[model samples]
Each structure stands twice: as structure tokens, then as C-alpha cells.
Target chain A: MYAWFFRELLPGPLWVRIILTVVLLAAVVYGLMEFVFPWLSEYSPLGDVTLEDG
Target chain B: MTPPLPRHADPAQRSVAAATRRQRRRRPLGAKIMGGFGEILITLGVLGLLFVVWELWWTGIEAESDRQDSLDEFYANMPARPAVSDGDDGDNDDDGPNPADFEVCYTLDDGTEIGCADHMRAQTGSEQIMGTVYAPRLGENWAAPIRYGVSATQIDRGGVGHYPNTQWPDEPGNFALAGHRNTNASMLGNQDSLQIGDPIYVVSYDGIYVYEVRERQVVLPNQTEVLNPVPSDSAAEAEFGVLTFTTCHPMFSNRERLIHHAEIVDFVPIGAEAPADLVHHEPITQMFYAGGAG
Candidate 1:
């Protein structure tokens, strides 16, 4: 399945396709770690330890 | 390739390719939607786990190292204390510390009683190490540096914070302190374990202030009275030095504040031998002077 997908979808040789896949995976992980997760964490109550009293 | 078979690639191969393409294109709408939703959920889960690791574990490691570095610098530059022969047995005949021995602060109106903390604070300015807090209940080696104010920069550095306006150690008022309950090294993570009469030692360059736990209370965050000269008794007069420990309650949650109050029972001068219970638990970096055991 992977071979078929890479062969049909990617416009490059096997080596180039492999490199593209790795770079794409890295980009997605970086985006989630650096941006998406941090924005979501602000809404999480786990790290919000401050008191509510004025 | 034997001359290309007109447009239909050999009936068998052509049929198989068409069937595969049809199956790929004919995925059910409900299945597609479910698959997309599942992917979203998995991504959310992975992100949540990563955040947990960052907040609970990575932050702790970073804060601990920062605090350790601060402690090392603070201790290394401390001046050597003057020797006093009578510090070892804990028996001094003077009604109060020798005026010539250390700077004294007459916080009360009488001007007779001396507050050693006034001297210590004067000696150690803002953002400096006010002292070292040792809680045997926390651990055999639980000692955190006490900085000047309560803020993320200070408390998050893996140490407790001393209220700026509150009384200093040995002062005839409350020496209030604050620390994190969970994140940033959680200096006071186990503060609730302190039992009544448990000795809480505050070690300064000048001397050690020993406070005995007398009570514990949970209060609202807005209740500033807990830090008053006399905790929860704003109008009541203060007679002796007291220590108060404040932290977020319920461990990981911060819906309430946990407070522990201790009364000063003794003061050990710089030259005195260290307290037996606190001897084993030294700072990560030790700065021993030629004149005293501190």
C-alpha cells in the first residue's frame, strides 16, 4: 500500500519520496508542538494554579 | 511491451485496475466522516500528552537547575562569620543577642527587643537569597533558597518566596512565604506533611531561625490576613516571630490556598553548630567559611 501510494502520488524517485515524507512528518510534528498544543494548553486547568479570590 | 493492446489493457488486467479505482472512490460517507473524526481525536490526545510532559516534567527539570545555580552563587559569595565561643551548647547568658555581634532591628515600639531579621534583610537586599528553608518533613535533604518576592521568576526557580512587606526571620511578626504546589519544581509540594511541632529551620548568613509548626489552615486566595503580623488576627498585636507557609492546595489544582503557621522558638547564630536534624540536608553546593560551620 505504501509503495503504491508513494509511486502514484509522489512526483519523484524512491529516495526523494522518502526524504519528502520525513520532512512532511517533521513539519506536522513541529507545528503541533510549537503552536497548536500551546494554544490549547492555555485552556487547560492543569497548570492554572493561581487563586480566584481578588 | 508487445504492441499496446488498443485502449483496453488485456481484459483481465484492465478490469482489475478499474475495480481497485472504483473501490477507492466509493468509500461510504459515514466511514469517511468517522475516519476524519478519529484522526482529530488522536491528534488531540498526542498534543495533550506532550503538553503534560512539558509542564510537569520538563519545566521541573529546568527550574531545578536554575534554582541550583542561584543557590550556588548566593552561598559562595557569603562572608565568613565571626566566631563566638558560646554558640555550640546553645547557651548564651545575654538577654538578647549581643548588640555588637549582629545588626538588630527594633521593630516593636519598645525598642528593647531586637529582630535579627531586620538586620538580615538590611544585609541581603532585594532578589538576593534571604535564607535557606529546611523542612525535615519534606525530605531528609529538602532545602530551598528563599528569595525576596513571590513571583513566577522567583518561585518558579525552584525556591520559596518571602513576602516583601512581611516580617523577616526572628522579627516579632509573621514571616510569610509562598511556594508552588505542583509546577516549577514545586518547592512546597509536601508542605501539608508538616505535623504540629515539626521544626522548620530558616538559615540565613547571620543565623538560623527555628520555627515550630503550631497550626495549618486553608483559606481563600484573597485572604491577605494570613500574611499579617498576626495571621487572621489583623487587630491582634504580635509578640514573637512567626512563620507562615502558603501554597496552592489540592496538589495539581489551585482552587484554594494551603497555609501552615509556625512560631519561632530559637535562634542560632552564624558561628553556632548546625542543628542536628538539619545537618545532613545541605544545599546542593556548600560554601563553608573559615570562622563558622555554616
Candidate 2:
């Protein structure tokens, strides 16, 4: 299914398609880092420590 | 059956054809399994690299901008400084009034530089930028805002967070702070680098609290005594204001915390010349004025 989709959706020759795939992967990584992960970390309680200090 | 060959095919072409045939041969089951495992390992490695970039680079970028915005807002809302005329006491210095004469001012032990503890004692708020901290040992350009809490909302903004229950800057107690070592901006990424007698300056709206590193220790995250007025010396009475900086230890791990303790030794009020340690750091001086209430 993925092979058929790529063959139909991707443009140009094999080298062009390879470059396009790499670009798409990079975009995915960037989106995850820029938005997705930050948003997810908001719910994390990692650094949320309150010390009723002595 | 004989396979068809090109009319111009030569001995070299025949060898190439044989090599192509050999390349088409199927791999053994064990080899195929190993290749699949190798591909998975490579995929995992790529994912790990992406995570590292997200943690170090992207987070730093976000936090820096957030810190800048917070500082801008804090500076904009600062109350104007009250005018103090130079008296005819034969000392007409342009560096504002002498702390000895002013009720709001308190001098350090040297009786020269004024303390800001009295000024900062009146200000308090949550998620607010208290002041800028400078540690030359951290780096020449190292300065982080002291926020009100040790949560994602504060620390993730690329600055250290002051423990809410702890004492304020120049206060006669422990003014403890926490930061990340490998995430966000990693404000205290080099907390372990601070050595004995190294200076750590905490600049509030009132003045710069100059602290000298006295000791370093690693402790568990839940060890609350480290935030005490005397720090781990619970039975001992507090004599002077102490500063504690905490961060995740071992880099990229959080199993333990690295803590550094410094004692407030001096205070340089606004309009006065910055301390000697800050002489080489002009940007800090610039930032101090930019955020100054005066």
C-alpha cells in the first residue's frame, strides 16, 4: 500500500523522489521538536518540585 | 535455455553480468534476521539523535525567547526610583545616596557598597522574574533570571527558579535556586564547574548580591534540608545569607542533584560601579541598567 502511494504521490525520477522523502522526514522531525514535544512536556511534572524548606 | 546477450557485449560485460546474477541471490535466514535487526538499531539511533536536538537546541531557543519576554515585562513594570539629592556632606558622588544616611539602604561589612536586601524584601510574586544572576565561572555571557518557582512554567523559560519558600536575595537565610542541567536552557548546566572562592552574583532590582562559592555537594532530590537557612547544618544557627544552586547531576541524568553553596559577601546598589568580578562582563552591566528601576 505504501509503495503504491509513494509511486503515485511522489514526483520526478528516483533521485528526486529520494530527496523529497528526506525533506519530508526532516519536516516531520522539525514539527515534533518545535511543537509536539513542547506541548507534551507541559503536562510533565519533572521540574515541579515545591520544598517547604526547613 | 540460453539467455539473450547484447551484440556488443565483451569479456568485461560478461563479468559484470555474472556479478549482477550473484547480487540477486537470496540471503540466508540468519543473515536476513541480522539485517532487520541492524535496520531497527539504525532507526532507533536516528530517533535518539532527534531527541537530543530537541532537548538541547530547540528547548534552549524557546526558553531564551521566553526569558527575554519575561525580563522585558518585568523591566517595564518597575516602579520609578525616588530622587535622592546629593547632600553637602563633602562627598558629592554621582552614584546616588550613601546607604549610611538612607533608611532604605543597608551597607555591607566593608561599609562602602550598599546592600539591596532591604529593597527586594518588599517585592513578591509568582511566575515573576525577580532578577538576573551572574556566575563568571559559569561563562562570560552566563546570566539567568531568578523566577519564583521550580516548575516547568519557570525553569523551562531558560532561567533558574528560586524556591518559593526560600529566603530572598541578600536575606539572612538560604536563597536557594534550582535549574536543569541538560534540558530546557540548562541554566545550571555547569553547576559542578563552580570552585571554592568563585563568585556568583545575584542582581535584583535593588542591587547586586555578590556571593562567593564556599562548598559543593551532591544530594538526593528530596533532601529538603539543603534548602535550609544554614543548609544541611540544621542544628547550627544561621549567621548570614547563603545562596544554594541545584541542578540535575551527571549530565542527561536526574538520579541525583548537584548543589553549590555560596555566601553573600557584598552588595552593589544601582548607580554604583559594578563589582570587580563584573568589570570584564560589560553585557551584565548593560543588562543590569536596562532592567534597573532607576
Candidate 3:
């Protein structure tokens, strides 16, 4: 239960924190993998009008 | 440093050295007692404080790691339901978990093979070697992984060694558990305190079972027969629905296995949905975190 996910995840115990941390980090990575990172191409300007926090 | 701080220097330095020598010779009342005998007590007090910190902070870290690993192993290995075999119409489940994902393992009485999942739900306040032993005889409602057992290492780094091949929780027989002799964690930490008929329990993913301490058995680790579900290790011999809990005697090391023998009385459902009693009955909140309100 106690993990480094304290920043989010379950609100009790060190394990919860760790688990939550890892879970959220994984979620973010998953989002980036599926959404933001896929649309990169040469003609498309690197600078975008909007960028959701990756 | 500077040629051994001048023994006799300028007036101020000379005075300071003289005062230093005088202070060494003029032991204060407290210092006078330091060498007489109190020093040993003071030293012991400091050591005890250090031991307390080690018991608390570092032990908690180790416990947390073990618990996390245990849970991971459980989730990774256990199937949603028990595994099934051929000719069983896919209903047979040999290796999967029942609903709550409780994975069981076996170990010897020497305290080796402390499972990685031991630290899964560890309370982080004090690293007092603690955990509950789920005894079948203690009934499903009475068991919990309370802080039991003695701390073998500096960080209280240890595991609850399964008494090899004892009856499983659901199996008809006694399931024994042993932890450290930690007073705060109690149980194994305080093996001497467990009295006869005291209510105990095992908090498992499947359910909770209430047990009553019936007797104590002081035996060497080699007397493995006591842990046998049949008391003889013969599969043909059915179990006696008993529970055996053990810990080190007189604290410190495993000089002897202080044991509590009990019997199961009730088997409460843990997280089963089909059983209406699971919804209507009092829910066991401590075992699984998101288990309440069902």
C-alpha cells in the first residue's frame, strides 16, 4: 500500500503514496504516448498554439 | 593541529590550557558519577534511544518495501478466480485467487523465506515489528496482521515465515502465524502476553476468521509435527480446525518458539458479491482499504 504515490493516489500510508505516485506517473506517460507525442511531423511547426501539460 | 595546541603559550592561552587541565581534574558532580556506575546506565539509555529510532524509521521503510512487493506479487500471479483444469468444465481453479487476490505461500519455522508481500498494508507510524497472523481456528472475524513478532535485524527487517504445509485458511484445520516480539506491535513482540481464550483473528482477502487462544506450546523449531495440519502431515487425516501462532520466547532471538494454539469459530466473507450476507453483514474495513460501505 505504501509507495511513492503520496502526491496523489490513496491518502493513507507510505505505500499508498508510492502506489499513487507510480499510478499517476503511469497515467501521464500513457496520455503522452497516446495523444501528444503522436502528432509530431516535419511540416507541422514544433511550436503549437496550445499544449496541454504533458 | 598547531603543534598540539601550545601546552604553555601566551597568558590567555596558558590560562585556557590550565583551566582545561583543571576541569579534567575537577570532575563535576555529574562527571564524578559518570565513571562510578551511572555512565553505563547513560550509555545504555543512549543505545536504547538509538535502537528505538532504528526500530521506528528504518524498520518502517523495510516493512513498506516488503508490503509493496507482496502486493505486487499477488496481483501479478493471482488470476481473478482460482484456476481450473481439464474435464472440469472450466470451473476448476488451482492457482488463481478467489475474489480478493490473497496469495498464500509456505516457509519453515526458522523464520527464513519472509515473503515479499509481508509489508503490503504496513502501518507507518512506528517501525515496531508488527503484523497479524490469520489463524483459521481464530475464526474469520478475529484475525488481523497486528504488529507481532520480534525484530531480528536492525531495521526490524524480517518476514513472517509460513510454517511449512500447515492448513490453508479455508482448509479445515489450524493455520499458525508468528511475528516479532515487538511490544508496540504486540503479539509476536509480546508472545508471553497472549492468554488462553483471548479472541484473535486473521484478516485475509477471502474473509475474516475469529479464533480463541486455547493453549501454549513451547517447542523447538524442529518439532515440525505441531504445525502439520493433521498433526501428522498425512493428507488422508483431516484437520482439526485449529490455529497455532508462534514467536520467540523471552524476546531477543528465536531461542524457542512461543506459540498460541487456537480454534476457528466463524468464517466471515471478505469481498464476495454473491453472498448477500457480505452486503448485509458487518463489513471488515481494516483488511482491505476500499472494502467498507459494501
Candidate 4:
């Protein structure tokens, strides 16, 4: 739904499309840097701790 | 009347009919794209390998040429400081063993001394500095110095400025030669590839001169005193028969100019053994390199 909305609606104008592209890239990188997955994986016993490698 | 088909065509007819039907079944775009992508990857892989090979070849030329310069410079250095290294020992005068100290008696196009005031003050740019550069060691024949920028012409005709303080066919002393470093086809820019101790010869109607590389230095633009008749050193050294050539360094930008310094080794008279062509002058000086100074 988010991908479809971004492709069909959020890009209502050229300026908005440019802004959306920048924001989406920034968010993707930010999410990775915040270790969102690693933090959650740490609490789960089944998660492979060795994969994080400190 | 039977229009006959060749015997080979009869056997291939069945295969051609099968291929025709199969080809008539058009391929879907997605399948076609996948097949094309595979071919593209293969082509790109081969190209990348060839590119690597080309790069290696280019790198070899640069390295080999520079190595030749390095070896030339090494061979050019001295076994020991010629007796002159003892500080104020050698006469170090204009009369000192220089190939440059000679009377240059010749008339210019304007019917004046070889380097009359009007001749030295000639204008700069494409039309003016477009004269022949005759170096006896490298090549004895006169090559027209390419003026303006390197792009304007392949043969560099150096800058239009005078030797600043020297006479035409300059008297026995250090003579300064300046050229625009950023210009196209400049002798200075082409010299980026020059190793230390390379020999440079500049001949004219006056006489033929052989300049052996002495030192290379990067100095401020105002360091013009080096052009003094005698290079002002810490101690009173020998008077010079010097040829100081300057150009802006790094080829394009002129924040500083690289200087190549040499002393006149042998000033051959005009009708003397100067070869008619520069290419012929090589073998004689090939084994003879300049002596090193401290």
C-alpha cells in the first residue's frame, strides 16, 4: 500500500516527487544505522546472535 | 518446366521449415529481455577485460619514459665534485670552461645586432615567438617554437619574453629564459616528463649552445635574482655561464613555476660541428652526461 501510494499519489507534483525521493532514501539509511532489526533480534532467543558479530 | 532447387537445399528444407514455424511463434518481451541481458553481461565482461589490458599498456609507456629520464639523470651525475666543489677553488669566471662564452656577430631581420633592443622587445603571442628552437644536443636543427597554447600547435614555441637581463646569444653568464607555462605546445610544459640532468640546446644566428642540467627548483615568482650573472650562493662560487629556464608547474595552474637550470657546456660556433638535423646530434651526447654538483 505504501509503495502504491508513493508511486500514484504522493508524487502529485514534480517538487513533491523530488522531496519524497530524498526523504525515502534518508529514512532507509537512518533505519539501517539505528540498528532497528539488530535491537529486536537481540531480545529474541531464536535470533542468531552470531550474525551481528559485534 | 521445373525450376530446380539445389541438392543441398532439399536435405535442409525440413530443418528450414521447422525453424520458420518456430520463429513465427513470437517470443514474449520478458523472455527476450532475459536472453539479451545474458548476452549483455557476457559482452560487458569481455570489454572490461580489454579495458584492463589497455590501461596496462598506457601505464607502461609512462613508466618506461620516466624510467629513461631517471636513468639519464643518474648517468648524468658526477663521480666526484669537480675540483670546483672545494668552494672558491675553480676560477668560476666567465672565462671558466663554458661552451657559451663567445662573440655572437650576426644581424637580425631588422638589420640590427643579433639581439638589438627592438628585436628583444618584440611582441608576444602566436605571431611573435614563432621562431626556431635549436638545441644541439637533443637535435641540432631548428624547430619552430610553437607559440600560444599547446593546443594551438604540437611543436612548442616558448614564450615571447627576453632573457630578461642577458644579451642576445647572451654573454658569458646565466641567461634566463621564461615562457608561459599554461600555454599550448610550450617547451616548458613538455618538460614535465624531463628527468634531472637532461641536456637542452638552443641555437640561433649567433651561435650554438649546449646547456647541461645543473638543478631543478621551485621558487617564488619574485626570486628573479637567481638570474644574476653569478648565481648568488652562500659562498662566492664560480661566475656562471648559466641558462635558467622557467615555466609554470603542473601544466595548467600557475601558482608556481618549475625551473630547470643548466650551465653552458660547449658553445659551438655557428659553422662548427652542429648537425643540420637535431636527430643526428643524439649519438654523440648519448653516452656523455653532465657532471654532478653538490
Highest DockQ scorer: 1
| Candidate 2 local lDDT, A20-44, one digit each (tens) | 9899988989888878767766554
Interface RMSD of each: 4.0, 4.8, 28.4, 27.0
The clash number for model 4 is 17
Best by TM-score: 1
lDDT of 3 by residue, A7-49 (tens): 2335754577668677876786555444543332112221111
Residue B48's lDDT within candidate 3 is 53
Reference-based lDDT, each prediction: 0.71, 0.71, 0.44, 0.44
lDDT of 4 at B211: 62
Off by over 4 Å in 1: A1-53, B1-26, B81-100, B106-115, B122-127, B281-294
Calculate DockQ per candidate and list them.
0.33, 0.22, 0.01, 0.01
Could you give the DockQ of candidate 3? 0.01
lDDT of 1 by residue, B210-250 (tens): 78999999987778888889986899888878899999888
Clashing pairs in 2: none
Residue B139, candidate 1: C-alpha displacement in angstroms: 0.8
* Prediction 2 TM-score vs. true: 0.73
Docking class of 3: incorrect
Q: Is candidate 1 or candidate 3 better by lDDT?
A: 1
RMSD of each: 7.2, 6.8, 21.7, 22.1
Tens-digit lDDT string for candidate 3 (B156-216): 2333433334555555554655554542123244445667877565544444455667778
